[model samples]
Target: MSPQTDDVALSTTAERKVVVQSAGAQPDKDWVIVTRGLKREYDMGGEIVRALQGVDLAIRKNEYVAIMGPSGSGKSTLMNLIGCLDTPNGGEYWLSGQLVSTMKDDELARVRNKEIGFVFQTFNLLPRATALHNVELPLVYAGVGSAERKERAMEALTKVQLGDRAMHRPNELSGGQRQRVAIARALVNRPAILLADEPTGNLDSTTSEEIMRVFETLANTGQTVIMVTHEPDIAAHARRVVVLRDGKIASDERNQKVTSSLGL
Candidate 1:
């Protein structure tokens, strides 16, 4: 992640974020994400279902936040919108100063490719590919030259302290290492934000903590991270936690636990 300009003040407190979101305007570039009255709906057998009634969120660069909710809380819908996988029906969503809600499919695809790096619960690595090769997948898709792709992939892997494991296959590496490889791949593009959906779901408790520590290191290095999960303990690993209920944010607060524990 690149260092953000000092010209913009940090929106650290929930009160500050409220001020930013309530402005109902596109935030400046320093604020990487802003939403006003974001909404999502579905029609099931002629019955209308409101997955998200109205969601207003503001996130600045280099913040590590977690979005957590129980089943039917619309957290997934919010994640999709933030990840650029889906658009809201009636709201404004601005990402890095662009109105994402109005972008067409092609534009959304490009934005997704350029701005967001995603980590799924499933590592999603090619079984036959080595860790280095797996980390090169995104660059390969972007048509990056082979030499540059390999170089960037190695740099990404080194960020997660996995450079030594680059040539190991997924089956040969432990679950934690494989997840680290996935995280490295996500970081290869130097996206503005890293969006992870239940990234530690498949790992054991110890391995999960290992992955969280990697995230902690990344956040310390100025990576903007947004994690969506149902587990409170996992959410506690983030510097800020936003809980959603009934399709709206129920609470947003700084996590003293993570802040003090991680020296952030």
Candidate 2:
């Protein structure tokens, strides 16, 4: 399908996903993902549907930010656009100082693989593969040697406290462990930014809290994290919150304590 068509599909899928995964809902100073007047429209049954009207956002590197809004609020559309999995119909997007808005689909994919680490709500782990294998997939795409890929994957798993589970398949691990594996996979590349769409959507409260702690640790270590969430409590864990309403930012504020405590 065409890039435009792909963007539309992602919007529709995102809108639907936003309904069930609603949960809690970023940073400033050194913005890593910036967007201005971003818009996305779809030709649905010959009618146009606007997913994002105009969204303006700025996320800083090493900052933990959450995107929150109600169903049909265009939060998911914003995630897709920011993740570089899809592009906007009209807007200016600068990711790590690069004009991603103008890149072709292939170029976007290459940049995404090189600069972004994505963690999905579903964990997105390969069902039959060992955690080590799944975590190494990105390196394989980047053409890293097998020996180096194994070393890097193991190092990532260790960072997430999952070194012992590396030989286990997704099905063999618990929900929290699986998510950690996914997180390890995302960090394996050490991308410019980590984009997580409902990263803890499927986990229980306790598990979710554990995941948030991991994110906190990541941000503390200077890893940029941008997550989309619907629950206010979950969003509270972030250093900054960007509230979206009908695709426009309604509020942007930092948790002074979290921000100051970490010096982020």
Candidate 3:
């Protein structure tokens, strides 16, 4: 797995595993995400497919990390685990201090709704709903009052620079504006982490760059973001890049260019 050229700031393997190696205990509050020997598998008929093989990772609060890999490299599986959308077959996962790898499906659902904000390639907006309504859906599901939901939804829209388009339907917005709305919706809950899966996959190059700038702004403002992308150019926008190969991490290093640009 070749990442775009750069000098790695992490000089030793030990440094990379410092937090990951702390097994059998709750991770420090300094780490917003941690995985100790994380593993996931699926059964295809009678055959077993191991998607993740003892993956150990640590991400602190406010860190912007990009996960990169080939199609079968298990990045998606790892994302699902980190997002609490799926439980692993083996090992421990801690997100915002909760050990979620052992949580039941119902419990996992609750944590996922409260802790992970997801932005997808498809935007996933309701075609008939206004941008404000789409952003309000999460709060609505959380049983928030209409007044409060509207206020928070507007705030989220403003964060993504979409407040002026709040009343517009998805069809009334450009591709970039729609994605911005999706980003606004994801931020409405102020989740512990924002997990984006190929967020630029559907957009043109210019629009993708626009969205990446939004992510950069959010990360600079202390929001933790985890983006899974295949393109090196896209991953380069992140301050750190983690490349996965054959279900394991092949390299995890800082992207000096982006890190320096962000002054992080």
Q: TM-score of every model?
A: 0.90, 0.86, 0.92
| Distance from true location, Cα of 9 in model 2, Å | 34
TM-score of 2: 0.86
> Which ranges in model 3 have alpha carbons more than 4 Å from their true place?
1-16, 260-264
Give the C-alpha miss distance for residue 216 in model 1, angstroms.
0.4
TM-score of model 1 vs. true structure: 0.90
Q: What clash pairs does model 2 have?
A: 23-230, 23-231, 24-230, 24-231, 24-232, 25-235, 26-65, 26-240, 26-241
lDDT of prediction 3: 0.88
lDDT preference between candidates 2 and 3, better one: 3
Deviation from native of the Cα of residue 183 in model 1, angstroms: 0.2
- Give the runs in model 2 whose Cα sits over 4 Å from its true position: 1-29, 256-264
RMSD of 2: 10.6
Which candidate order results from sorting by TM-score in descending order?
Answer: 3, 1, 2
Scored by Cα lDDT, where does model 2 land? 0.80
lDDT scores of the candidates, listed in order:
0.87, 0.80, 0.88
Index of the highest-lDDT prediction: 3
